[model samples]
Target chain A: MKSLKALNNPLSTGQKQLDLLHKGTSETYKPPLFVDTIEPTGHFPMKAKGVEVLQINMGKMCNQVCKHCHVDAGPDRQEIMTRATLELCLNVLKNESITTVDLTGGAPEMNPEFRWFVTEASALGKHIIVRCNLTILLANKKYNDLPQFFKQHKVEVVSSLPHFSARRTDAQRGEGVFEKSIKALQMLNAVGYGSGDLLLNLVYNPSGAFLPPAQASLERDFKKKLKDQYGIEFGQLFAITNMPISRYLDYLVASGQYEDYMTQLVDAYNPMAVEHVMCRTTLSVGWDGQLYDCDFNQMLEINCSGTKNKHIADFDLEALENRNILLDQHCYGCTAGAGSSCGGEVV
Target chain B: MSKSYYEPSDLGKFGDIKDFQPELAEKFFGYYNSVFQEGALSEREKSLIALAVAHAVQCPYCIDAYTSTSLEKGSDEEEMMEAIHVAAAIKGGAALVHGVQMMNKAKDMSM
Candidate 1:
């Protein structure tokens, strides 16, 4: 499928003014404004506790266009990060006390400077995480050796496998994705992933409008099915709630499910989940070297609030740590039910 | 008077039953919530059973609630459909098994 950007879809470039759905009458059930909803719970003007994870978007050039992608990333995108930006990121890591550097992208591997950044970041003694879409490892012969490369760098390999069933997974991601994902997972296991401390994790988001299942039970099911059927082993299954933004927001609006889906998100809000939101510890660097509160904020052009020009070159940790996390209706996605983050359910 | 007996929105008002009879509703909900927790049977197992029971009674609200609950508890399409089949078989069997009584009564009426 072509990306929203490639198709010239309204939701693609127009997301800067995306609606947060804070509307309704006093007599009716309007989901309360996300910021207001948190006030009673003592999270008014949510602030970042610290920055421990540096999530860098290598670029928006991915091989496949999954339906729920927030990045609107696909092969048509030309926004690869330049070597200068990556060098600046490395310099920041060298100076800051930040511990982990997470590499993500259309597919981070698709970035020309991807390997160079990984090698450089690994050299800094920084824990590295690569948000690999498993199919990329099998997309081309040149990309086939990524598993071995990741294993060497001690990079935590996190890939999305929406469902263990091919029909369900492919329905959401794309045709033949489940087959290729299984093949790639087996490849990772062959290199000792999911064994000892190699740390291979799979991510699951619901195929449709519903929230993801309980993380522990779903992980058990994923482990048993992958092991018993395809002889694949994965360490953890991160159940991330799909945020209503970009391609996913487009899906909700087009399917006539916008109100129902938003209602579900609002009604299921959990205050405990807010306390562990990924944004508190993570800073997202966009492909163009700009900084965002989180990846979702980056997608929506919601930059860090404390500074005027919050770019990676600036690298103001103290300012960013104190900045109020910019909130929107989309944030309900992160705090819904068990809560969602890069590492899965926060609560 | 919205004409339809089952309003999808009514499911959200399931808690409003407390406004009518708070003590009884509270006790029932306490029991209902605890019944679904992981115990002798895993929560997944209980969800499948609940899904089957929802189908057996043919309650629209229950069918909707349990269908989503079953999925949330990690029950897949195949397992969920299988649970429905269990409900179907028992319901069908309840009618067919009564044939033996009819057969005996017919014999009693034999000339």
Candidate 2:
């Protein structure tokens, strides 16, 4: 019940400290459920059918250190793919019929070879996607020209805009991030990215502990709200189910919110969403050139079987195609409600 | 960095702090209530989100409340188990990421 200012002052780091102090104050009190220690009943299902979507984790390096980022991406992270790995990925792109070459990262633009990959992929008529953390466009001078670069390539840019409001967005990201994001969005808009036909997709994960509202409904609401409130225009609003991980998990723990959120995801499990899970069609490749069933599994380091090519150099389309997918609790996020993926609702 | 922003002494100010600004407290409480209400979201949906959020924010009270709530809302044991796994993946990935910071620090320190 402390003032909202008091709650906001310390930031997430402060919240974590408060949790520790609170725990120590109540010596006789029994600890709450050990949500992290709870073992999952089923293992990750690893039956990968085919790699239609080629996702490349350009690196772990990013501009913003947001609260719910599953990748734990930040400027401090240096786990970037080397030029050698880039060549390997590009080599696979050459022989493979990958319709979509998804380039992701701390910020895909952070990678020195990002343009190289995008240019090559586009030349091959491959649909290229950059999982942009919009603020990155404004993070540095070198990146300021990204809007123009993206326009030239016609890359389908999927940017994360956690909320329309500055406060909510900044609460998840860092202070002033919402302002930068707005500026970046406006920049993209100027380039006709989020305008009528430029194909700029904005992603919106719930700011609080909840599954996103229905995709169609939420998108409609977002389009209207963003346009009316901020004069923002975008093609689609992708409501991604925040896969509980990393800093977000730490936030849940620090704020004593872990168990409730998990229960929420579990209770909202929708079986109809399973068939359209993005992993069914797309294959996620990590920074080190390793392969994963999907992006979530890649984040978890769950690799495909030994028979298949583990890295991009070993991009055996026949081998990776029809492999078993590895599913854990996070997979439910992709299968919950209308389902969620980098490209918006799966089903 | 300090692990928490609030001290045990701060809890004493909880109700009293809100007492001064009754309207703001009411607003937050109202927003919180509406968030949990079964409007577009079902009771089951609320519980599931509370559970996922419990993991995301790492709140014990929220976690405890939603766990039971999810079960009561007819969530099966397996579904609950999977949600935890999602939490684990995210948590684990985040922690492993610190290795990059460590590596950076080590390189800088060495220099």
Candidate 3:
């Protein structure tokens, strides 16, 4: 892992990147703005329908630097949720309206108090989701029992396995990631995690600059390949579109695919998908307890679109619900094609 | 004014053909739309075929459009490139097969 300061310097200087995106959205190559495209469908300025899911970005400290990671999470990242912030989240969960807690991070498991937070959240009887990177469970001896811990809590584990093949997965993520991820999946399966009662969902984002194949078709391929090759099983597979932000944005710019990719996203905007976007139902809590409409907005540092109650400490359900979700060019990623969200295709 | 045989911007204005011959343009567009629609072949399968034809005909506009279309329709790079190779094989084979005509003509002349 590189030093945190070194890894984050580019992000601090990323205003140029943002400007490039802005130019695309506002000037040349304009398809209708994402918000405008949805307005006629009565879904513009997208508001939270309800807080059914509370997605907590535990921190930016991750075990690997995946190329398309919108979180820009890597081993060098030092951001971790403090116990105090976790307590605030737990307090919010007491409301019962938030029925699910979706935990994400560089690797949510890397947080020192991660299990404690999960244990307490599970006691609330709410469905719990952990966006596991798979490799982290195999990264260290202390973290090896993550599968058992998750099973005990009955946590729904959603992991990224970009492809079932080693070459593609390792290309997007780091070297040997696919092998470690397979081992982690087998370990989870051994504990009955992928079978009945325990839900082990695998996430697939494209390895290059393209939308994922239809979730149903891709899931069949994953099921056959994983079962035939490694004798693995899982409940569901989620096909996620790579959000054009953070490391992926950097890749787009560097590879000269930024404009074309954004054009594709804008051109493929699906109004039907706008109504069910994750941001409509999920409140993303950042590492420091700040709030955003979704995790991609959190990475771009776009706060929730409101004048008040922008942090978990100041969480007011009514006020938060009434606030308009922020809009930007990046919003196209969520609305493109079949529509994309943490749960996979919306439409 | 400046002049060039092919203007990159012309691709975006493809719909503007209606301004000249409205009925014919409309008919052409209708035919084009129907052609791409699913029939015996799926839209994805058609897009792959269009991509292969784009390369064989060396039409930059078709190449650009069908490449993106194929991707949107869920074709991976490997499959898409393989489609191009299929085009390449036929193209190369067509030229080589014509050599038999030249061989016969040369033998006749020499005799």
Which candidate tops DockQ? 1
lDDT of 3 at A261: 85
Q: CA lDDT of each candidate?
A: 0.88, 0.72, 0.86
Residue A82 of candidate 2: its Cα lDDT?
88
Cα shift from native, residue B105, model 2 (Å): 80
Residue A252, model 2: lDDT of 67
| Candidate 3 Cα errors over 4 Å, as ranges | A1-10, A13-18, A24-33, B1-111
Which should have the higher lDDT, number 2 or number 3? 3
How far is B38's C-alpha from truth in model 3 (Å)? 6.9
User: A167-260, model 2: which lDDT tens digit per residue?
Assistant: 7678788899888887888899888887655788888887667677656655665687678867878888888888755455556666776665
> How close to the true structure is residue B103 of candidate 2, measured as C-alpha lDDT?
99
Model 2 stretches astray by more than 4 angstroms: A1-46, B1-111
For lDDT, the strongest prediction is 1
**Model 3 residue A239 lDDT?**
85
Clash list (residue pairs), candidate 1: none
lDDT of 2 at A94: 71
| All DockQ scores | 0.57, 0.02, 0.27
